[model samples]
Target: MQKLKWGMIGGGEGSQIGPAHRLGALADGHFELAAGALDHRPDAGREYAERLGVAPDRAYGDWTEMLEGEKGRSDRIDLVTIATPNSTHFEITKAFLEAGFNVLCEKPMTMTVEEGEEIVRVAEKTGKICAVNYCYSAYPMVRQARAMVQNGEIGKVRLVVTAFSHGHHGDATDADNPRVRWRYNPEMAGVSGQFADCGIHALHMASFICNDEVATLSADFASTIPSRELEDDAMVNFRMQGGTVGRLWTSSVAIGRQHGFDIQVFGETGGLRWASEQPNQLIYTPVGGRTQIIEKGEGGLHDDAQRLSRVSIAHPEGFPLAVANIYCDLADAIRGEIRDGLPNAADGVRSMSAVHTAVASAKDGGAWKDARPSIFK
Candidate 1:
C-alpha cells in the first residue's frame, strides 16, 4: 500500500514518547514522516527533524509554523500526531482538525473538560478525525477481550477491576526532578496527577473492554509525597452505564511495580484477565470449566485480534506495536474504512469528564459524582 504523508508536533529529542511515536508511525509502512515541529526550541526541533529524515522545509520550528507550512502545500500531510504536553493538546488538536487535517492526539486530549468538549464540537463541525492515543486498547489480546464481551462469550459483564501503577517516582529524592515534579504541579499537569495520567488509562480500559461508558464514580486520592500538590495515588469506584461495577487503582508510588497495568472482567458465565506485561495472552475461565490461556495468534480468535496480531504466537509485540495498531486503524480510517474500535474525540472527552469528576469526588471525601461530560449528559 502507498504510504500516507504524516507530520508530528512535539515528542522531540530526549522525549520519552518521541521514539515510540517515530517507531510506531513508521513500523507498519503505512505512514512516512513528512513534516514535523518536533521540539520546543526551533533550532533543536529542525535539527532533530532533519536527523529523522524530514525535509529541511518541512521540518518547522513549532506547531503553528508547521500548520501554516502544511496548510497550503499541494501534498500536505494526510495526518498529524500531537505528542506535545497535556496543556497544548486542546489548542493544537482543534487547530489541525479545523484546518481539515486528521489528528491522533496523545491522551488527556485536553486539560479541562470544557476544552475537550470544544474539540469534540470542532471535529464534528469540520468533519475531521480527532483520535486520542489510548493505544493500550489496540493491543491484540485486549481486542480479543473486547470482542468476547461484545459476542457475549463472557456473558454480561458484571464488573471490571483495573490498575496502571508504577514505582518510578516513589522516592522522595526524585520529587524535585523536573520530569517528576511537573507531573504533580498544578500548573503543568492540571487538576489531578496520577489519576489523570495513569488512572485514565485503566479507566478507559474498563470502559473499552466492557463496551460500556462510566456513569458515576467515587474516588480517594492521596499525595503520598507531602511536597506534591496532586495525588500520587488514587482509588476509584465506578458504575458503568450498563450497571457494570468498576474499580480502578493507579499510583506512581507503588514501589517495585513496573509498567503495572492490568484488567479483569467478571461476567455472569465467565471471567477474563489481561495485563500489559503479558500482552499476548488473555486468561479465561468459564463458569464451570478449567481456566484457559488465549494466545493472540491462536486459532478461533476474533477478527480484530487476529488482524492486529502481527507476529506468531509466543512472539512478543510490545508497546510500540500496540501503538502501531492504532496507526494502522488510523490509516484505514483515513482511507474511508470504518474502524469501530478506533478511539476518537468522544472517548477523549469522556475521559476528561471522568478525570474532573474524580477530582471533585476525591475532594468531597469520595462522594459519588456523574462522570459523563455535560454534552453527553
Candidate 2:
C-alpha cells in the first residue's frame, strides 16, 4: 500500500510530543512526513522540517503558510496532525479541517467547550476526520478491556477508578520555570491545570473502557504550590450515563509517582485493571474466581486487541506504539474503513465540557454539575 502523505503543524524541535508523533505516524509505514510548519520560528521550523526529510518546498514557515501552500497542491497531504499548544488547537484544527484536510489534534482539542463544539460541527460539515489524541485508549490491552465490556464479559460496569499523576513539577522552586509556569498559568493552561493536562486521559479512559459517557461530576481542586493560578491536584467524582460511578485523581505534585496512570473498572460479573506502567497485561477477576492476567498478543484475545498488538507476547510496546495504534486506526478510517474506537471531535468536545464542568464544580465547593456539552444535551 502506498503511504499517505502527512503534514504536521507545531510539535517542532525540542517538543516533548513531536518525537512521539513522528515515531508513531511513521512507525507502521502508513504515512510519510511530506509537509510541516513545525516551530513557531519560521526559519527554525523550515530547517527542522527539512532535517526530518520533509522536502524543502514543503517545509514551510508556519501553519498559515503551510495551509496556503498545501491548498494549491494537487497532491496535498491526506492528514495533518496538530501538536500545538492547548490554546491554538481550535484555530489550527478548524482551519485545516475547513480546508478539507483530516486532522489529529492534541488533547483539550480546544480551549473552550464552544470552540470544541464548533470543531465537531466543522468536521461534520466538511466530512473530514478530526481525531483527538486520546491515544491511551488505543493501547492494545485497553482495547481488550473495551472489547470485553462490549462483549458483556464484564457484565454491567459498576464503577471506575483512575488516576494520572506525576511529580515532575512537585518542586516549589521549579514552579517558576517557563515550562512549569505555563501549565498553571490561567492564560496558558486555561481553567484547570493538572486535571486538564492529565486527568482527562484518565477520565477518557474510564469512558472508553466502559463504553459510556460521563453524565455528571463533582470536583475538588488544589494548587499545592500557592503561586499557581490553577490547581496542581484534583479529585473528581462522576457518574457515567450508564450509572457507573467514576472516581478520578490527577496530580502534578505527587512526589514519588512516575508516569502514574492506571485504571480499575469494576463490573457486576468481573473487574478489570490496567496501568500505564504495565501496558502489556490486563488483570481480570471474576466476582467469585481468582484473578487472571490477560496478556497482549496472546491467543483468545479480542480481535481489536489482537489486531493492534504488533510485538509477540511478553514483548513490551510502550507509549509511542500506543500512539502508532491511533495512527493505524486513522489510516483505516481515512481509507474508508470504519474504526469505531478512533476518538473523534465529539469525544474532544465532551472532554472540554467535562473539564469546564469540573472547573466550575471545583469553584462551587465540589458541587455536582452536568458534564455533557450543551450540544450533546
lDDT (tens digit, per residue) of candidate 2 on 1-377: 99999999999999999999999999999999999999999999999999999999999999999999999999999999999899999999999999999999999899999999999999999999999999999999999999999999989999999999999999999888999999999999999899999999999999999999999999999999989999999999999998999999999999999999999999999999999999999999999999999999999998999989998999999999999999999999999997989999999999999999999999999999999999999
Residue range with the least summed lDDT across 10 consecutive positions in model 2: 171-180
Best by the lDDT measure: 2
Q: Clashing pairs in model 1? A: none
Model 1: CA > 4 A from native: none
Candidate 1 matches the true fold with a TM-score of 0.99
Residue 26 shift from truth in candidate 2, angstroms: 0.5
What is each predicted model's overall lDDT from 0 to 1? 0.95, 0.96
Clashes of each: 0, 0
